[model samples]
Target: MIAARSLFRAGAAGVMALCVALAVPAVAGAQPYPSKAIQIVTSVGPGSNFDQLGRVFAERLRQKLGVPVVLENATGGQGLVATRRVLNAKSDGYTLLLTSSGLATMPAIVKNAGYKAEDFVAVAPLGQVPFILYASSSVPATDIASFMSYLKSNAANLNMGLLTTSHITTMLARKFGKVVGGELVEIGYRSSPETLSALLANDIQMVATTHAIAGQHVALGKIKAIGVVADERTQAVPDLPTFKEMGYPTLVINVWEALFAKADVPKDVLDKIRAVSREIVSDPSYLTAMVPTGMEPWRIPFDSLQSVIDEEAKAFKKDADELKISFD
Candidate 1:
C-alpha cells in the first residue's frame, strides 16, 4: 500500500512538471506578434485612387508580413470617419489609417471632426499629387492667360465644380477668381467623378482636380489642362505649366496621403511598421502602381514624420485662417 501511494504521488508530480514546461513559453515569450490579420482603414470610397493606394499597400503587406491585410473603407466626413475608427482601435500595429492630404486640412475645415493633426502619427508618406485645372474643350480658353481673360469677362456668370466649399480645391477655385478679376461661382459635388461628369456634360465650365482622374480625359481631348497647382511641373505632364509660371505663384495645391497610427503605439511596433513602410514605398511594384497615376514616392522616415506633420498642420491652419474659411 505504501509503495502504491508513493508511486501515485510521483506520477502526479511528473504530470504537473510537464504541464508547466508546456505553458512557460506561451506566458513568457509569446508568439511573434501580428501572428494574425491586419487591417488598413481608408477615407475614400471604393474605385477611387485613394482606395487603389490602400489595396496596393495591403497587397504588399500580405507578401511582406506573411498575413492577410484587409482594407476597410469608412468614407464620410471627408476623413473623420476613418480617422476616428483607427484612433479608437487598439494601439497594436494591427490597425492603420491610410488617408489623403485632406488629413492635413480636414480638421480645420470640417466642424466637429473631434480630432487634431497631432492625434495621429504619420508612419508612411506617399508622394504629392498636383491638382490640374481642367477646362472643357468647348470652352474658348486655350491657355492660362486666355482662361483668366474668360473668367474676367464672365465674372460671376462662370460656374466651377468643387467637392465642397471648404475643400482646398474650392479654395483654389476661389483664389483663381481673386487672382483674375471674376467671381467664378462655386458649385459643390459629392465625389470627384461627379465633378468630372459635370465638366464633361458642360454642366460646369471648369474643375480643379487631380491628374489621375483628369489624365484620361485630357488624352481623349475632351478637356484641356491649363494650370498645375504644384511647385514644379510633374513628370506625368511635363508640358503642363505650374501655377507660378501662369502668374499665380502661391496657387500651389498638391495633395498627398500617408499611413498613420495612434500616437501611443509602442516604439518597437512602430519601428517594425516603419521598416515595412520603407520597403513598401521603395518596392518596384509600388512605383509601378504610382506611375499610372502621376504619383511619385514621398517616403518620410519614422523619426522625422512628426515634425513634418506639425509643419504641414501649421501651414494649413495659416492658410485656412487667411481665407476666413470654416466648414461649419
Candidate 2:
C-alpha cells in the first residue's frame, strides 16, 4: 500500500512537471499575442483602394495572430474619422489604423484632426498606385503638353473633377494651376462612380483619379490618359510618362497605404507584428488576393519601441501654410 501511494504521488508530480513545461511556450505565445479579435479601422469605403488594403492586412494578420479581425470604417474627413477611432481606442495591439498620404495632409484640411502622423506607427507598406491624368476623349487635348495648353487657354471653360475638396487632388490641381498660370473649375465629387459618370456625360472636361477608376474607361476608349502623376511609370501603363518627365516634378506623387497600431505596444509584440506583417504582405497568396482588386502589397515595417506617436506629435507641421481650413 505504501509503495502504491508513493508511485501515485510520483506520477502526479511528473504530470504536473509536464504541464508546466508545456505551459512555458503556451504562455510565451500568449504574451506576444492578441488573445481577442483585432480591429482595423479605415476611412475609405468598401470598394475603395484603401479599404481593400486595410481588409487584406486584417485578413493576413488574423491568420498570423490566430484571432479574427474586424474592419471598422468611419468614411470621411479625408480618413480622419476612421483613423481617430483607432487612435482613441485602447493602444493595445488589437486595434490598428490604416491610412494613406492624407495622414500628411489632414491637419491642413481640418481643425483638431484629433491625431497626426506621429500618432501611429508603420507596420507595413501596403502598396503604391499612380494617379492617372484621365480626360474624356470627347475633349480635344490628346497629350500632356496639349492638355496643359488647353487648360491655360480655356481656364474658365474647362472643369476638373476628383475625389474631394480637401483631398490631395485639390492641392495637385492648385499646383497645376499655379504652374500653368490658370484657374481650374474644380468639381469635388465624393466618389469615383459619380466622378466618372459626370465625365462620361461630359459634365466635367478632365479628371485626376486612379487607374483603377479610369482604367476601364481608358480601355474602352471612353477616356484618354494623357499623363501619369507618379515619379515613375506603372507596369499597367508603361508608355505613359509621368508629369515630372513631362516637366512637372512635385506633381509626381504615388498614393500609398501603411498599417499602424497604437504608439505604446511592447517591443516584443511589435517585433512579432512586424514579422507577421512582412510575411503577410509579401506572401504570394496575399498579393494574389490584392492584385486582382487593384491593391499592391508592399511591406514597410516599424518596431514597437519606435515613434508612431512621434509622427503624430507634429500634426500641425505638415499642414500647408496656405491652407485656410475652418471647422466652424
Candidate 3:
C-alpha cells in the first residue's frame, strides 16, 4: 500500500510539473508587451529625412514605452532591403519599420519589388514631404514650362537625378519626359544626400528632390526650383509655384512615410503604437521641430491607414499602367 501511495505521489508531481511548464508561457505572454528593447529600422541612409525622423520618433517612443528604442539604417535597393528585414522579423511587437509610402506603392512601377502592400500593416501615418523639381543654376529655365522646353531641346545633354529609380521621383521625371516629347537621362542615387551632392556638383542637371534638400540650395542660389510637386505652396518656400499652378496639374506629387509592422502583430500592441503616434504627432513641440525640415503631419487613425494605402496604390497603378512603367 505504501509503494502504491509513493507511485501516486510521483505521478501527481509529474502532472503538476507539466502543468506549471505549460502555464509559464501563457503567464509570460500575459505580461505587457515590449518587455525588451525595440528596433525601428529606416529604409534610408543616415542623415536622410526618414533617418532623422526615425531617430527623433524613437527617442519619444522610448520615453513612452519605458524601453530602449533603437534605430537601424537599412539602406539600398530603394528600401527593398529594409522592407525584407521587417517582413522576416517575428510578428512580436519588438521590431518595426519606418519607411515611405513608396515601399507600398513602388511595386506598381517596378515589376520585381519583392513585396506587396498587403504583407505589412501601417501602425502610424507620420508625415508628407513635398517633392520639388530642381535644376542647376546653370540651366536657363526658371519655371516648369521653360524647363520642359529646355529639356526638350537639351534632352541629350541633361540627365535627371533621383533618390531611387523606383519612386515618385522617377515617376515625375518620366512624366516630364513624356510631356516634353523626349526622354531625359534618368540616374538613380541611393539616397537624397547623394542625389543632392550630385545635383550641386552638376553631375546631373536636373533632380526630383525634397524641400529639406533643395530648399537651402534655392535660398543660396546654388539651384533653381523648376516647380514644387505639391497641391499648395509650402511654408518653407511660399513663393515657389506648385506644378498645378505651373499648368501641369498632373505632375503634383508628395512623398510620405509611415510606421509599419507585420500584419499579424497583436491588435493591442498595434493600438498602443497608434495611440503613442497620435500623441507624438499632435504635440506642438514635435510639430515645431519638424517644421524646419519641411515635413507636415498626415494624421490618420490606425484603422484607416490600410484604406489610405489601398487608395494610394490604386492611383499609382493607374498612372503606372498609363505610362507603361515596368521594370521588366
Candidate 4:
C-alpha cells in the first residue's frame, strides 16, 4: 500500500510541473507592448533638420516610453525606401517613419510609392519648417522683386538646385520659375546641404531650402534670402517677406515633420504613443531647442491627422498634374 501511494504522489507532482511549463509561453506572450527598443526611420541623412528634430523627440520619447528609441536614416529612392521600410515593418508599433510634408508629394510624383498617405497612421507632429527661396551672392538681387527681374534676365543660363524631385521645395521652385516667366534649369542634389553648397558656389542661381540649412550662409552674406514660402514671415528672418506678401500667394509651402506608424497598429499602442508625444512637444525645453533650427511647434491633433494628410495629398496631386510632374 505504501509503494502504491508513493507512485501516485510522484505522478501528481509531474502533472503540476507540466502545467507550469505549458503556462510560461502564455505569460511571456502577454507582456506589454514595446518590450524592446523602437526604431524611427527617415529618408534624410544625419545632421538634417529632420534628423535633428527626430533625435530630440526620440530622446524625450525614450524617457517617456521607458525603452530605447533609435533613429535610422535610410536615405534613398527619394524617400521610397524609408517609406516602404516602415510600411512593411510589423504593425506592433516597434518601427515608425519620421517624414516631412514631402511625403504627400510622393504619390503625386512617384508612380509606385508602394503606399499612400492613408496607409500609415499619424502618430504626432514634430514641427513646421518653412521653406525660403535663396539666391547665391553672385546673383544681382536682394529681394523677391529684384530676384524675379534678375531671374527673367538670366533665365536662359540660371539653374535652380533641387534637393529632390519629390520635395515640396522642388514643386515651389518649379512654380517660382513659371511665375517669373523663366524656365530655370533644374539641378538635383542629394541633400539640402549639398543643394545649399551648390547655391553658394553659384552652381545654381536659386534654391528653396529651409532656414536651418541656409540661415548661416545668409548671415555671412554668402547667399541672400529672396522670400519665405510660408503663410507669414518667420521671426528667424523677420526682415524677409513671405512669397504671399511678395504677391505670389500661390507659392506658399510649409514643410512639416511628423511621425507615422503602420495603419493597422493596435489602437491602444497608438494612443499611448500620441499621449507621450503630446507631452514631449509641449515641453518647454523641446520648444527652446527647436527655436534656433527655425522649427515652430505645430501639433496636429491625433484625430485630425488623416484628413489633413488627405487634403494635402489631394492638393499636391492637383499641382503635380497641372505642372506635368511625374517620376515614372
Candidate 5:
C-alpha cells in the first residue's frame, strides 16, 4: 500500500509538470496584438496618389508600432482585387486596405464586387482630393457660367472623358451633365493620364479628374479648369471657384482616401490603429508632405468614420441607380 501511494504521488507530479509545459507556449502565443509584421494593401499602383499616401502611412505606422509595415500595391480589377485581398485576409488587424472613394462605388457598378464599402471598418481617413472640371483649350469656355452655356449649345458634339465608368468622377460628370441640361458624351479611358492625354490632344472636349492630375496642366495653360467639384475653393487652386460657389451645389463632390481593416477585427486592435492614425494625420510633417499633392487633410472622428463610409456608399448607389450605370 505504501509503495502504491508513493507511485501515485509521483504520477500526479509528472502530470502537473506536463500541463505547465503546455500552458507556457499558450501564454507566449497570446502576446499582445501585432507581434508580427503588418501589411497595407493599396488599391492602386506606384506613382499614383493612393500608393504615395499609403507609403507615407506605412512609414508612420512602423515608427509608432515598432513593427515592420509593408505596403503591397495590388492593382487591377478596378480596385476590387486589392479590396477582396484584404477582405479575405485573416481578421487579425495585420492586413489592412488603403483605398480611395472608388470603394463606395464598387457595389453599385461591379456585378461581383464580393464586398460592400461597409464590409471593411474604416480605420482612418487619409485625405480628400477635389475633382476639377478641365476643358481642352480649344473649347470656348473659361469659367463656370460660360462653360454651362457652351455645354448647352454644344451638347451634341462635346465629349467628356472618364477614367472609368465606375470611377467617382463618372458620377460627378453625369451630375454635371444633368445640372447643365446636356447629355455630354462620356468616353471611358483606361487611366486618368490617358483621359487627360485625350483632352490634351483635343480628342475629348472636357475631362473631370482630380486636381492633382489636372493642376499642373492648368497652370501651364495646357487645359482650362472650368470649375472645381468641391464644397469650397481648394488651396491648390484658390482662384478657381467651386461648382457650389457658381450655383451648382449638387456638383460638390470630393474623393477621399482612407485606411480600412476587416470588420470583425477586434475593437481593441481597431482602437489602437485609430489612435496611431490620428497621431500620424495630425503631424505637421505628414501634412507638409501631403498638402502639396493637392490632398486636403480629412480627419473624420473615429466613431464617425464608419457612418461616413456608409453614407457615401448609399449615395453612390443612389447615383448609380438614377444614372442607370452598371458595369455588369
Candidate 6:
C-alpha cells in the first residue's frame, strides 16, 4: 500500500510541473503591449510645415488608438536622425516615424548613408505635393515658351537654386535641362525654405520646389512659376500646366511623403498601423485640412509600396553614381 501511494504522489508531481511550465509562457504571451502612450517622430521642427501636417495626423491617431500620440522632432541630415531612431526602437508598436520622400532620396544624396533602399517598409503614403519650376521675377520668362527661349540665349547668365542635388526635384530638373540643352548653373541650399528665400531674392534664375513652399511668393508676384513638374496640374494651382501637357514628361516629379517602420516589425503590429493609417486618411476632415496646405492623399491609387521603395532606391543609387553625389 505504501509503495502504491508513493507512485501516485510522483505521478501527480510530474503532471503539476508540466502544467506550470506551459501556463507560464501562455500568460507571458497574452500580456498586453503598448498599454501606454505612443510616439511619432518627424524630421522637421515645431511650427514647420511637417509639424503642422504631423499634428493633424497625430491628433487623429490619438482618437483611434486611445493612446497619446506624441510628436518628436529629430531634424537635420535630411531626416536621417529620425530614420535611425525608428530603426533602433524596440520591437514594439509604440514608436513610429513620419517622414518625407527624402526617406528614399537621402541615401542617394548622402554618401555612406548606412541605409539601403529596402530599409524601411511603407506603412502608407500619407500625402503628396506637386513639384513646380519657378523662376526669380528678375528673369524675364513668363511662360514655358519664353522660358525655353531665354535658356537658349542666356545659358551663361542662368543658375538653378536647389536645396539638395540628391532630391528628385534636382534630378528631374537636371534631366529637363539636359534635354533642352540648357545646362543650367546649379546652386545648393541647406534646406527648402532657404532655397525659396534665395529665389525671392533673385539669387538664382530658377528654383525647383513644391507648390506650397513658394505659393505665397508666387501669389505676391515676387516669383513666376515657369511650369509644373508633376504628373498633373494640382487643383490648388490649376493654371500651371503639367510637364506632360507641355510635351515633356522629364519634368514630372511628385514629392510623396509616407510613414515607415522597420521592416522587421511584427505582422499584427504592421497590420494595426496600416489599418489606422488608411482610416485616418479616409476621414473627410483630413482631406479638407490637407488640401489647402498643398498636400493630397492619393485616392486608391495602385501603389505596391514595396515596389515603390525598391524603384526609388534604385533610381537614387543610379543618380548618385551618375552625378557623383557623395559625402565622402
lDDT by residue (tens digit), candidate 6, 124-213: 767776778898988888988788778778876888887652366567657756667767687888777888888888788787787778
The per-model lDDT (C-alpha) reads 0.80, 0.73, 0.81, 0.83, 0.84, 0.76
Q: Which is the leading candidate under lDDT?
A: 5
- Measured with C-alpha atoms, the lDDT of residue 158 in candidate 3 is 87
lDDT by residue for model 3 (1-328), tens: 9999999999999999999999999987776877899998888778767667767778888888899999998877767889989888999979999998777777787767787888888888777777778998779999888887888888878888965534677778778777777788888887677888888999999987778777798889998988888877666677888888878878777677789988889999988888998888778887777765567766566678888888878988888788776664
Model 6: residues with Cα > 4 Å off, grouped in runs: 1-5, 8-29, 164-166, 300-303
Show the colliding residue pairs in model 4: none
Lowest lDDT 10-residue stretch of candidate 5? 164-173
Over the stretch 1-328, how does candidate 1's per-residue lDDT look in tens digits?
9999999999999999999999998888776657889899988788776677668778988898898899999988767889899989998889999987677677877788788777778888766667788998778987788887787778687789989622777777767776775667888998888999999998888988878887898888899888788777776788888878877887777577788888888888888888887888888888888775456666566578668777877787787777666686
User: For residues 77-161, what per-residue lDDT tens digits would candidate 5 score against the true structure?
Assistant: 8888899999899999999999887776688888988997667878899887777889999998899999888887888798898
Candidate 4 ranges with C-alpha deviation above 4 Å: 1-28, 152-154, 292-294
TM-score ranking of the models:
5, 6, 4, 1, 3, 2
Question: How well is each residue in 84-183 modelled by candidate 2, as lDDT tens digits?
Answer: 7887888777887777767655755567878765666667677767788888777788788888788778877878886773466766666677677877
Q: What does the lDDT come to for candidate 3?
A: 0.81
Best by TM-score: 5
Q: Give the root-mean-square deviation of each candidate in angstroms.
A: 5.0, 6.9, 3.6, 4.5, 2.2, 2.7
Candidates 5 and 6 compared by lDDT, better number: 5
In candidate 2 the C-alpha lDDT for residue 15 amounts to: 100
**Candidate 3 wrong stretches, greater than 4 Å:** 1-25, 149-157, 201-203, 292-294, 299-303
Write out the backbone clash pairs for model 5.
none
Model 2, CA-based lDDT:
0.73
